[model samples]
Target: MQEFAKKPTAHRHPLPHGTLTLTTNASSMVMCAVLEQDTDDCCQLLAFFGKKLTSVEQKYSAFDRELLEVHRTIHHFHHMLEGRQFVMQRDHQPLVRSFAKTADAWSAQQQHHLSAIAEHSCTIKHLKVEPLPTSEEYRYLFTIINRSTRWPKAQPIWQQKAESCMKALIGWVSRHGVPYIITSSSWGVNFMSTLWNSLADNLGAKIIHTTAYSPEANGIIKRLHRSLKASLTARFQGGIWRKELPLVLLGLKTSPHTALNISPAEALYGQSLTLPADTFQHTMSPASPSDNRKAFERIMPAKATYHIARKVYIPNELQNAEYAFIWVDAHRIPPHSPDYLGS
Candidate 1:
């Protein structure tokens, strides 16, 4: 056998310019997509809009309209995703600030939708929009996340009142388990701090808030929202938002989680939950020895040996009804005739 000599290995080259890096800043809006490894046939859509709407009507006038639009868009987007995953990013600071001061009077339906969205993991960050240096274009700075494997389905809740926001958050925590942590931008720090102060007393859970303007910290959740939005948009075309919201949510619950390779419902429940279908049926066999024995006993009759013994004595009594017995000594002399012996 001939031995081969080792050759010198070449050094690896550094990443080229414009190459994407995983450790991007989190203070801006990020758009993440969720796609299957095998095929792109099934796609979901999610986007985080962090634009600040300014109006001349009043200081708080833009609050209600902008909030309503956000809710409407989210509802519409969910329908579009249908059965896929997506992510969306939002400016953490302003988003939380808006919620802290303006979200106390939301309607019941709005609260429900908001709470549902808030259940997911998210990050807070500052998104600064500036004008282009020389052109008429504007510079939009935001964050984007892809493939948030651990966290999924994040929702943004903006309220003007801190107390109200805390109440709503507590309700969400009660319904759904607590998240790993709470993240927000610089503006959100105060609100989160106040919120966390009462977490143990009100929510019964510890809430650790992340640094301001660093959304990449909660990348998983942001990516999930993007995938969810994309799927919703593609699935529901020109459908009524209110009518399709529930269906979209159901699709998410039933869809399989990529990381765990199981549906959320199954992971949470330990067993797969059944959906409504006419053809669906289940047949279970007895599992334990006692169960099997009980099943067999149900099909057999009870034995009655005591009743049989009593029945046999009745026949013997009827056959010997006319018979009578008399005792006689061994020294009897007359044995020829029965009547003479007796006399």
Candidate 2:
């Protein structure tokens, strides 16, 4: 838990004789930045900052998070490097060349970070990273996909790295057919041109960005998350949450939903999941209890109505006959009336 003594301030200070560098790295949960003065042999730290990301920030793509890391570093050390030229180092290649190349598809937050960096003319460098792990190590592990649901593991990856997300998504698509649409927040990864273009061309599916701060727009997924959390908490404690996550997910998928009137498995596969309880007795699936009165309303005939016509007479002669008819209204001109006009 080593701490740096020099804190960033608005006051000016004498420029360093040598080059000053800002190196930053960002992950799903945290961002770390280190400001140092480069010497002949080694680098001396001027300031160091590490901050935890919020829930919304955690969903940002790798490129956007890296850009955010650079922006925060520059703002924190504004006084020290006001007029002096410095260098920016990041591990994400897209971010390293973001200013050099046009980023028309960059998110709002990424554009803001790029604008902040443009205020200070600095050179960008990319950090060389080791090759990430492939799906080979995970292959021997989850065999339940073949035996049970025919779906990928429903739990988050252990030691998840940057490339793991894309790999997992590919695996899912291979097992299940292409989905029609994907809805997610405006995270940097969701906007990746390479990832989306392939999806559009191959699957004819597009990603839809959810409105900010509105969880209700994705209520079903949120409800599923809560259900999984409650199920996991009931069965496991503390460190065992990760271990039993798959079991809970299976139960959730097999259980029936009240609104859909069927389990997720049945909805997807068009058949009910078979548990270990009973066998080939040919049990009949119960019909959904629908009210006959409501169902019959669509086909029922409209209520029958009878129409009656009233007769009226006038004191006039018919055109073809030599007969005249006299009109009398006994109901209106009552017999007791003193003066009643008759035609």
Identify the leading candidate in terms of TM-score: 2
Q: Per-residue lDDT of 120-166 in model 1, one digit per residue for the tens?
A: 33222344543222212212112211122222332232333455456
Candidate 1 to native Cα RMSD, angstroms = 37.9
What would the TM-score be for candidate 2 when compared with the true structure?
0.36
lDDT of 2: 0.61
For residues 1-343, write the lDDT of model 2, one tens digit per residue: 1244355443223336868888888866798887877778766677778999998887776776777778887888898878888888877887766788864986677778788789896888887854223342331121113112222245355443324455555666787756666554444453444655565457677767655545555444555555765785677654445566667777876786654445657555656567655475688776554643443333222222223233446435555666544443234545666443533
Clashing pairs for model 2 are 61-188
Q: Please give the lDDT score at residue 302 for candidate 2.
A: 25
User: Could you say which candidate leads in lDDT?
Assistant: 2
- Cand. 1 Cα-lDDT: 0.41
The lDDT of each candidate is: 0.41, 0.61
